[model samples]
Target chain A: MEGETIVKERRILVAVDESEESMYALSWCLNDLLSLHTNTNTTVLLLYVKPPPPAYSSLDATEYIFAGDAIASMEKYSRDLAHSVMSRAEEVYRDFHPRVKVEKKVGSGDAKEVICVAVEKLGADILVMGSHDYGFFKRALLGSVSDYCTKHVKCPLVVVKRPKNV
Target chain B: MEGETIVKERRILVAVDESEESMYALSWCLNDLLSLHTNTNTTVLLLYVKPPPPAYSSLDATEYIFAGDAIASMEKYSRDLAHSVMSRAEEVYRDFHPRVKVEKKVGSGDAKEVICVAVEKLGADILVMGSHDYGFFKRALLGSVSDYCTKHVKCPLVVVKRPKNV
Candidate 1:
């Protein structure tokens, strides 16, 4: 960063699960991007992915988490979800930044598809995501979404580590 | 993974060089690990990071690239610079790993420290490497031996997307 100046204008598309995991990923991006920006025209999109609920045949006991209303009027729900996450994240961002313009959005579909769509649709310069550290058994049994995203996305993607517990 | 049973008995480490923009980090890991197995106990470590080069303000750019004997004690001369990267990675690892372990390391120093420490001292599962992708502004940067291996370690790491055709 010696003689380099920060470029603050790129659109940043981030996947937010509203989970601790997402907070970790978002913080890293916010912090790193903040360090590099010259306030070029940056907008942060916090995209939340809600995987469709599993059917009765599905082995997951947690299917209920995404049931009924979770999938109903997904577009409307996603909009609200995005708004909620961004509203909350905005408060945190203000604490560190005063001039940054941030926005949020919600989408429905497979995590990978949602992300891919967001990048193309939003013209994002970067995608920030968090990886859930799964146990050997769990990972072997179920494939990793984060790993898949790391493999598929075209833009500069970062699967950031969890932030330290301050 | 349909009917296929997952059996990761050994551990391998792959490092990804962080300094350079990386495009084919994982493919590189797969190529190397697919070939070797340490008694069926092998798992690949797709590493991609190394520490920064030690201050050689006294040494010229030529001296730094050709760091003579100080690098001999390490692995291949091609990957000599990676030796000092661990200083920047802020690595945090668990104490015990059960089966074939796939780990990612990031180092801020030179490339060798991350690879050597993970392979020779830390007992990495294997190593994989690849050159970074080149954009119009950045030319072939990750291909430097020291930079590529810095992202990988010993064992059987694979390499992919070594070419910049992309």
Candidate 2:
């Protein structure tokens, strides 16, 4: 305790997705973590990762050709999805603690890789995420983003599990 | 801020094991989380879950029979392992912040189930655990305990990932 200094402002980066579990994790962070530090400067960064667009293959060019307008609409849809998720997260944060500073960030890449890189780039003190609660068989089929992030992220990570009753 | 009551004492249950990841998690909790609340009542519960002993079967017991002394010594070893983990956690807490109230708990059962039950019974505000950082194939072959707890636990959870350089 002699030389140790307490951090006044804690940078908390929360990864958000379009799932109830993610929303629940955001709510918990706002209510339980941020609310407690009302007097301190706690910056909460809301991050949403969009999957990288599908790659164009030479053989697929003949089979599945995308129209110009279709590509534009698809890009627009991805942007809109990112905005919507951030807006919802902001709404929840405002409802819980309006005065707290929050920033929205959207990254493009694989979810796990993007999250880890963002945490490092942002210099976040802690990274909070939501568990999708996949079953054994389902997890085997579809990999877990949180699991990957937990191992790869440079900062401390928190993976929140939404209670069933909640 | 009007009429809002801040929780003074937050009970944080940290699940520790005989892994470097768990020790790193304990260190992070002390430096990042608990250090911020030195003036307040912050209770950190260090929990270690030992896998339950193998069930004995009569048919195969003829070839794989364990002596009475060996069984007693194995039980003793498990108990000692639990104690050693908790002691190490306590030492880390003491080294970082001695003022924080720290409690050690050991449970015998599946790691995931024990952690969830301990969080509920202890009325913990949050449960912090460490990830083993298994790769895709490794995790697929042997399931992750932290991943399981993240899905099953009722309270807020933090899965701390040790930095590569640290």
Whose TM-score is greatest here?
2
Give the poorly placed runs of model 1, Cα more than 4 Å off. Answer: A1-8, A53-84, A96-98, B1-166
In order of appearance, the predictions have TM-scores of 0.47, 0.82
Query: lDDT of model 1 at residue B106?
Result: 43
DockQ, per-model, please? 0.03, 0.49
lDDT of 2: 0.80
Task: Estimate, for each residue in B49-130, the C-alpha lDDT of model 2 and write its tens digit.
Answer: 8879866566455445555556678899999998888877777887655577788888998888888888899999888888
Give the lDDT of residue B64 in candidate 2.
Answer: 57
RMSD of 1: 18.7
> Model 2 clash tally?
0
lDDT of 1: 0.53
Which portions of model 2 miss their true places by more than 4 Å?
A: A1-9, A38-40, A56-66, A95-99, A134-141, B1-9, B36-40, B57-66, B95-98, B134-142
Tell me, per candidate, how large a share of the native contacts it keeps: 0.00, 0.55
